[model samples]
Target: MENKEIARVLWETADLMEIAGEDSFRIRSYRNSATSIEGYPERIIDILKDENRKVTEIPGIGKRLASVLQEIVDRGSCERRDELLKKFPPTALEFLKIQGLGPKGIALIFEHHQITTMDELEQLCKDEKLRLLPRMGAKLEEKVLRSIAQYKMRTGRFLLSFAHEAAEELKKYLAETGGVEEITAAGSLRRGKETVGDLDLLVTGPNATEVLERFVAYPRVHEILGRGANKASAKVGREGLQVDVRALPRESYGAAMQYFTGSKEHNVAVRTRAVKMGFKLSEYGLFRADNDTRVAGESEQEVYDALGLAWIPPELRENSGEIEAAGEGRLPELIELKHIRGDIHMHTTETDGRASLEEMAEAAKNLGYEYVAITDHSKAIAMANGLDETRAVAFARQVRELNRQDRGIRIFSGLECDILKDGALDLANDALAELDLVIGSVHSHMNLEPAEMTDRLLRALECPSLRVLGHPTGRLLMQREPFSFDFDRVVMEAVKRGVHFEINASPERLDLNGNLVRSAKQRGAKFTVSTDAHHPKHLHNMWYGVVTARRGWLGPADVLNTLPAERFRNAIRHN
Candidate 1:
């Protein structure tokens, strides 16, 4: 089975067991195993093939979990998952997808009201029956109604991060099949859309039949939708997300990739240009329209050159004025992952993080980062075990001691301080002055009027200790909407105050999204693309932030954390 499919099954089992009131340790074991499997760089099947390999070597996979994974690889399903499904109505799982609902919430509604489906839950909310249940109110009922609407709008789409994970595993599996020469993921994933409905994979090889056979027999294939000599389609996992693979001869690889990796609008624009240039363009190859003579098709650059333009990065192939820029030889030298020098917003066990301060620092060093900031939560976010003045000061002392060891990476003591309802900071100025940097954020009162929200942020910007704004809009994709506010005014005030905004790299919260980043950039504002990591493994998420910045047309000069250690410290001090 693919790693994502295995991970999905394990996570679903965890959710079901949680609702079943299983032992907390067992539930946590499943959760941890799921996380480890999802983030693992290689397929478990490949790992298990080594003669000396032991599944116990995986961080969270003990003997029992390894057996379960092995069973999934041998068959397409697991016994534990099937057992749990038998105890609940088949439709019960669907309710968990609704926002404002968790395993506990679903169990409560099911036991009390026998609600098993989204339709029944929506009816209860509309009839005002949900408000009579425990912990349910009129406001929550309204929120549920809105959440259902949003959920329906987002149905059939997977998060970009999830799609990328699946694509990576599938690509690796296919590449090792011996006959595959080149394989590339196409479709919305190549375009870097925030969410995608399905995946398109294009392959070129000498043995087309061998590639097609291996693709159809992939262990994660839940069902084969169709098959042919050179193409096949299959549905994968419980979500029934379709994946289509097409094998092509080597000569037409580039043209097919360009055709499949398209925004319809961008493809139309390119074809129009081809026509104007007295040529024809198709997945077969570029050709002379008058006599069907082939021109260029061996490479992507050749395809672009046939139309008299430079090669455009896949992220910019959205028909959003990228063609005009390329025609003028003005395409941006987009930022790459290697250009990042530091991660400026992260946490440790002092707040809610799972790793220790030292572990987080060592992980940053492993990533070749010159510096990392420990921006734990401040006192306003009590749920995260946020630090108060005394704890904050003590934490600074610990950081100082660690830095004194010359650990090969600079550690900056910082706090993700909360901006309170009245625009005051959660930490006192005396406490803030003890830290090397500060990241101001909003943790509550997210439903204020637009003017109030704008004023709240503007007032926070006035504080001399505030250096960066974290998750500026407070958005969680597919679950919560960004709180209403005057974003333009917020950006303007941030620019005037010399406060940097963050591109938070957590998968669920890529806040200050691409458009806002571009808007801030156009207005001469600087930014920091940070992971906002709470665990050592999460440090690798920095690449997601870098991609978001590239989509916004940002370069190395637009990012503050790219500076060297001394210069970065000076920049933060001056701000």
Candidate 2:
């Protein structure tokens, strides 16, 4: 079993221990071990077995936690962790994942009515089981039900790219139909947050009044949630579509965009810096020494230059030392989407994707993209209907025919080959060599110890045919965490061996997160920011990867897809 899986089990054990009224320090140690195990640089087994090694060497772990880590890694389970969990009903820890319920509330529920599951809890809520208990009442019961429903109905936020596209569509429609001249998507979508909460568009046109009127009256506007003279809110299907239309002097457009696209913390940092310099900054523009007159600049860069600071990358504008970096003129040259010439990771009908070869080609053509790597899954991924050697070869032939037809898009027949349990490639080297690109990935063995998982990935990276590692960490948002692995070493080796890693744009799996991306970029390793889309609509998710790339402070030149098709193909073919 992997160290990460072991850690998760141990984490649950700790939570259960907490519910059972175990010693606070004891429960805290287990929880600490869980967090430490997540980002471990080496395998837990090696740490456990080594005489000189200490688990306290791992960050967030101390001496008490170290022994627990050793016991879990060496014996596949820890007796202390198990013993504590046995005291509490197993359901106690399970309820902790629910948002509103805390340890105390859970204890009350379990102690009173023996509620073990969500269903049982719901039944208790229906039967007024909590009302009879001391302190709990009818209103709290309703709130709990509401919280439970919310937990059940909760969906992850859309990727920034999806929000951008939606904004673009809305902007275009508003301008064409609503006659708005200045339409821009503001908020996190503009600032390039990795995920977006909602779509915010600011419009400024000759007919501001008419535009706002028409926007609120548009057919797609399901209900007028709110309407004021300067701004309005409406329901566009289920997602909250908040549209704000305000009348401002045209010169302030740039500042307005910057202000609205703020990480509030970042803006405060900038404002404080401005204050220190004896100047006042606002969304309207930079003011005079007295903080009253507006300066000239219709662009964000101009505004920053006026303040003697380099324009900060939107992704890094989260107040995390970016202001200091900007002041020092040491801002990172973020990666740009235009630098991506080709997409090295994608799917098609051969696996579990919506597009056909021709449709994908045409879409690439429309995007002015140079090339695409069609990496269908191999036979091992039965869930995705992966291809075998025979089918893979046939797919290559079809790609060759398409190339010959001069479709204006270079097609690289690639395989998203699975890394086997024993740290071997799913395809033979010869089979792998036939493809233009190879995106080796780990789908199983996710529960392996950090060392084993790292070894598995490293072995795959050592394969010459492996050009790109898709979603290197292999997380599924809140559902799962990356198993224990030596990511630092894995990235170092992948970079040294000329392997490309991906910032997968799948909403659920934005693996190779901004922090990791920054680390890899610093080492001169290349990356492919791909949508990893399963449907046509998903292709638009490229923006999510784009935003994530920006968050890593990546510029266009860092990504392989930003290259033109021929150059991209040559790079992959040779590397």
lDDT of each: 0.86, 0.75
Each candidate structure's TM-score, on Cα atoms with residue i matched to residue i, is 0.89, 0.68
Q: What's the lDDT for candidate 2?
A: 0.75
**lDDT, model 2, position 273:** 71
Task: Report how far residue 574 has shifted in candidate 1, in Å.
Answer: 4.1
In angstroms, the error of model 1 at 422 is 2.8
For each of the candidates, the C-alpha root-mean-square deviation to the true structure, in angstroms, is: 3.6, 18.4
Give residue 448's lDDT in candidate 1 (0 to 100).
94
lDDT of 1 by residue, 325-353 (tens): 98999998988888889999998887888
Clash count, one per candidate:
0, 23
Candidate 1 residue runs with Cα over 4 Å from true position: 1-14, 17-84, 102-105, 108-116, 123-141
CA-RMSD of model 1: 3.6
Clashing pairs in 1: none
